[model samples]
Each structure stands twice: as C-alpha cells, then as structure tokens.
Target: MAAGIQQQNAAEDIVIAGAGLAGLAVALGLHRKGVRSVVLESSPERRTSGFAFFTWTNAFRALDALGVGDKMRGRHLQLQGLRVMASSTGEIAREMDLRVNGKLGPHEVRCVQRNVLLQALEEELPPGTVRYSSKIVSIDDQDGAKILHLADDSTLRAKVLIGCDGINSVVAKWLGLAKPSESGRTATRGYARYPEGHGFEPKILQFVGEGFRAGLVPWSDTDVYWFFTWSPAPSPDANGKEDRSAAAMNQFVLTKMRGAKVGPEVLEAVERSEMSDVLAAPLRFRSPLSLLFASISKGNVCVAGDALHPTTPDLAQGACTALEDGVVLARCLGAGAERGFGHEEGEDRPCLGDAIVGAGDGEERERVVAALRRYAGMRRWRSAQVIAASYAVGFVQESDHTVVSFVRDKLLSGVLAKTLLMMPDYDCGKL
Candidate 1:
C-alpha cells in the first residue's frame, strides 16, 4: 500500500474507480453534463476477457442518455424472443416474446461484445480521460475529501469518490461491506466465431436441465456467445489446477451435454470457440437485503455497479442495472451542480467554473453530501428488487429437487418468463 501523503495540488471534483462499464459510463454521463471526472482503471489496458453482455431496452435507454446508443446498437445482433427448452429432452418448452409490451419503441434484447461496448464508451470520452494501470491500494476520508493511495506510490484527493470496481472491489471493502458470497454455481462462457457467417436467426436459445442451464445468443452473422451454468462437483483439491485448454474444456462441456436435448448448432458453436476464450468462474452475489440497508456512501465516498449490487445473471440484468446506476448517479450530481451544490471557496473543480459563485465551503460540502445520499436513496430499492428477483430466478432454475423441478418446469417457467419479459422499462430522466 502506498503512503497517505497528500499531494501539493488541490482535490478533484470527482474521482471514479474501475474503468469498466459502470465507471466509464458515469464519467461519460458526467462529461455530457459538463462535469469533469477522472477515471482510474487497475488493468493495464481495456479488458478483452469478457465475451459478451445481453443488453435489454433499459440498458439501451441508459446508453442513449450517455449519447452512445446508436453506435453501440449498430455493433451487435438484435433478437425478438428467447427459445426455452427442456435440457433433458431438448424439446421446445416455450418462446417468450421480449417486446410483448412494446413500451421501448422497436428496441429488442441484443447481445453486444463486452470489449466493443467498452471501446465505444472510451472513444466518446476526451482523450486521456481514463488512466490505466492506476490501481487504488487504500482510501482515506479526510476532512471533506477522499485521499486515495495507489499501488504506483502516488496519491490523489477528490471531493467525491465513486467505486465502480467489480465484485472483489477494494473500495467496497473499505466501505465495510462484506465480501461477495458464492452462489454454489459456476459459469463457463465463450464466443463462437465463424468467418463464413453462421446462418442463424436472431433469437436466444436456452436449455434447462437438472442442476444446469445453458444458453446461446448470436451476436452477429459471424459470431455467437454461449454460456453454461452448473453446480460444481466436489473435488479433493479445491485449488487444484484443471485443464483449461480449449480442446479440453470444449470436450468437457460437450460431454456434459452429450445426452441432452441441445441442437447440433449449439454443439458446433462450442466446438468453434478458441480454448483461451472459454473462461469459467464461480458465480457470486451480494445479499439484496444487505445492499438495501447498508450504507453505500459515507460522506463523499460511494460505490456503484458490482461494487454496490452484485447479483446472479439469471435475469440478465446485472449489466443493465449497472448502466442505470451510472446514469442516475450522474444526474444526481449534475442536479446538485445546477443547484449550486458543489462549489467551494478558492477551489477549482472542473466543469463547475460558472456554478461555483456565491456558495460558502460549508454549504457546498453539505449539498454534495446530500446529492450522494439522494443517489443512494434512488438506487437502493431498485437495486434490491433486481438482485432479489435474479437470485430467486436462479434458485428455482437450478434446483434439482423433484418438487421444485416440477414447479419450475410445469408452473413457474411460463408465469415467470412472462413476468420477467414484462419488467418495466426504466428511464433515468435526463442529465
């Protein structure tokens, strides 16, 4: 950890941690409102490991607010509905139309490559906005500002800090939040590429089996993203190295689905994936109740995205909700600035030059804190509901008990799928 020695310069208006989806989106949102923020990323460069994200209309609305919706929409494939099937027999269970409500114009569920989205967000920002390789080691809430200690032996002070780091966020730990709990399931995801183009319709194909679930979504004519989730089998050595070679993992996944009802196209997609691209990890989520009641921000230090509301991907709302957080948080801060809330005496915070007049230091700090609290208040219940729903969906889908499986297969699947499809679209107002 770097020492907490303060630098000679003045504090920044806002400093965001983790330049992933949430962090970069917030920065871009703030920029659109004429509020400047510094984004710090721990990684040496943009992440390429994440294969793809299933983005819905709500996420697209948030992106549109940040002014990158059309560009992002053009880079992916759109789907009208999902094909649910029985994993054991591979029989078509149901087809749930995604646009049943028709509330989001013509927008439908789409799958975007994660790196492509990140790059689009990065490109929208001014050059040099994101500082890579700048990992934070420690944070101290001093007086009315946050002092950050980076692993590179440097320090920075900001009036407000937003932690958009993922599940293992150092900033969340500093906020006294418990570590994320594993969901007792593991996920393996990869992208299947075809230079010759895959002749597949725009739809998501999902299969549910005992203690396992699998899905495939065509990202474009040439690329498709696939995922499998299953309860892990006990191993004598928990930390033992397993073969991660593409051929080995592909074989492992194929063997698991060998007698299942999956189609030949699904098998072919997995076989086409590069071994290095097939990544697996244990799924984890933060308790929604804890997230609802916990203090996400103390003074000017706060957290967002997975750092604030990590949940299972059963509902495919994790990324969508994170995008919502960025838009809402930026709007709150921008509203505060409009109300003369972020100014201070003799302090030069970017993007608030004209709004700094006539506010005392004490008054400014009070309003800034108020803005952060409002951000938390607005997000708390919304995030809790999504987290809880996602967890419940996962529980029912993954249960192998005879009674639970019967309820899921016969009753819950139809009702729950429709209810999920009818989930109201969210708009974060405007910046």
Candidate 2:
C-alpha cells in the first residue's frame, strides 16, 4: 500500500505479523531506530469493537520507552487506586493507594477503550506500513532470514520475522517453538458506556464472591470496561454465572449483578451495547521454558510479543509485556548485542551484520538456533515470574481455599499492592 511496504522481494528489511498492540509497537520501535518494517494483520482492519482495557504505570513505563506515553495519558482516566472486595459479601478486602508507589505520574493506573488504544497505535505507524486482511499461513526459514507465506498465496520476506500473533499463534509452531498449554479457567471481557449516576467511583472496582470474580474498570468519564471470570456452570440451564454460550453468558451476568452495586443502569448499558459476540475462551500459557521459540534469532529471523510469551489476563500485563519485548528485541539487534552464551563484542561478531548477510542454509539454521537459545535464556525466567504473580493475583482475588483466601485478601492486600505498584522501577527496560 505504501512505498517500500510491498511483499514482492525477499530482501525487504523487516516483516511483522499481527498488527495488534504488540505488532504495532514493534513497528513503531523499528521506525524509531530508522529501520523500515511492514506489519501484516489478520484482522481485516483495526478492530473498532471490543471491551475496555487496563494500563498500569508499569505498562505506562513501557509506553514511555516507546515515546507514546503522553498521548495515552491524555486519553485515559487515571485510576486513583485498586479496590479489591469480597464478591459474595461485597466487603472491602483491600485498598492499595496509587500515591504509595510514586511510579504513576500523579495517578496510579489508567483504563482506556481497547479500540482507542489500538487506534492510537495505528496512527503512529507510517501510512500503508500495516497490511490488513493479510493472514500469515506459513513461515519458512531461509538461510539468513524468514519467508512469510500469506493466506492469499502472496509471500513476503524480511531479514527478521516476528510473530506478534496472539495466544493461538501459528508462527510459534511454524518456527518450532513449544505449543500452548491448557489454562485452567476461562475469561469473558466486554465493554459498555458508563451511564449517568452509575454510583461507581472511577476506580478499578472488583467483586469476588464464592466461586467467581468480576472486575469493573472505568475507561473514560462516560464508559467502563468490565469482565467476569468464573468456573463453568454445573448445569446447562442458562442463568449467566459460568458457561460462555450467548444465552448462558447473558443469564450468568444477569443473575450475578442482579442485586449487586452494578446498578440497573449499568446492566441496561451492558445489554444494549453488544451481546451476540464475546471474547470467551479457556486461558492458556506456554510451558515455563528457557525461551518461547527454539531461538530468539535464527540468523536474521526472530519472534516477538505473544508469539513469544502468551500470558494470562489476570495480571493485565500481557499487552504491556509484549510491547516491552518488541522494544527490547529490536534494541538488542540494533545494538549488535546478544545475551547468554558468553556472546562478547568483537570486531567480526556473528550477531552483527556479517552473520545476517553471509548466512547460508546450514549456517543460517545454526545461527537461528543459537539466537533462539539466547533469547530464551534472556527472557524465560522474567516471563515466568510475571505469570506466577498473575496466578497469585487470581488466587488472592478469587481463591476457593478459605484460609488462604482470607490471608491473601486481608493480610496481603494493602502492603503487598503498594510494593508491587513500585515494581515498575526495576530495570526491565533497555537491552
């Protein structure tokens, strides 16, 4: 669509799959580095319909790293604190103050419409840099680079290919990474316009009950996005508590929020917004591996975003981490550095342009393997730690175990949350 955006030759600079936040972020990062890239999105165009999403200061830091922090801040309603409560009792279990961390710029967390974020990211890309409706059917590893075969029988080649495709990424397997694991539970996310007099404060409001937890986050002065995570219902009679069938989901929601603080207006808004389609599926994650792909780089080939690590939404860090990975991966390559394997800076280093340019079939495979191994070593543990924290969050917010739940919700709520909100201070940025 744009000059230098065509997929005709095998010598293009970089090709990124999936134009989600992760993909778009990577494209922007590459552009910042003066590297040209072409982003291929399976979605016909930017998805305008969806729920609201959360963005913590930690995520904001990542966004800042990519130079779009202020733009996002202008559009979102910065949350003052996180309110965790007992779902069944509606009793306040914990309250973590945003000011405690000092990480968030005046406010602690921000919620914005999912489509809004996507639109902001899309606007940053050079026009035509994104090719929608172009799904990647296959990825072939060449001697030094990777070739992407599209669904329409077209092909594109680049010095590097990143599979920013989501949890059900086809590129990971195509590139020989491990398959996704069967996550234990499912999540249903939706968005609705915040009606007048909803009575809910503009904060991250969570309700944890006997067997389920629902979160309500305000994305703007007039709208909020909420989600209900629960175990599948025991019976088929759709009353809305657990199953994802349209009727069942609707029924489940109706029953749960029937008398809760969600209010009649909010319920009416949710019903009026959209109900035929919802993002409902069992959560999944990659096995705790040293790395996602066999190697981070196969000669000039590499993977990024969920294509590398598909985490649960319990942490709300999936999109954040993907954006972080996209930025960091590009930095490592741009700086001509590779971690692990005692890779040192040398005059004629393999990580530099030499290996990329002279790589033959055999040498290319070996180089790619080495890069993948190195990439795994650099990122696996950190990703696992985040995943574990997210699982712990799920437990603290909705554990069935009585004693454990009490301790998690009561004893650990305030102090622990304060500590975590400051975790963005860690040096996860840069190579």
Instruction: Highest TM-score: give the candidate number.
Output: 1
Give candidate 2 misplaced runs (Cα > 4 Å): 1-10, 102-107, 195-199, 233-243, 257-273, 276-278, 289-296, 337-378, 414-427
Which TM-score value belongs to model 2? 0.82
Clashes of each: 2, 15
Instruction: Give the Cα error of residue 264 in candidate 1, in Å.
Output: 1.6
lDDT computed for candidate 2: 0.64
Candidate 2, 1-431: lDDT as tens digits: 32222346445556778888778887776666555567888777786654566676666766777778788889877777777777555678777666453643443468766677777777877778888888878777665566777777777765666778876777767667677776666677666664663455667777764556677777777666777776543354456454566656766676767755444544664575467645566677776544533554445455667777776667677776776776766555444333211122232334323345443334443444455455556666666666666665665565657886677666877654654564444344742
Q: List the residue pairs that clash in candidate 1.
A: 90-261, 246-275
lDDT for 300 in candidate 1 is 71
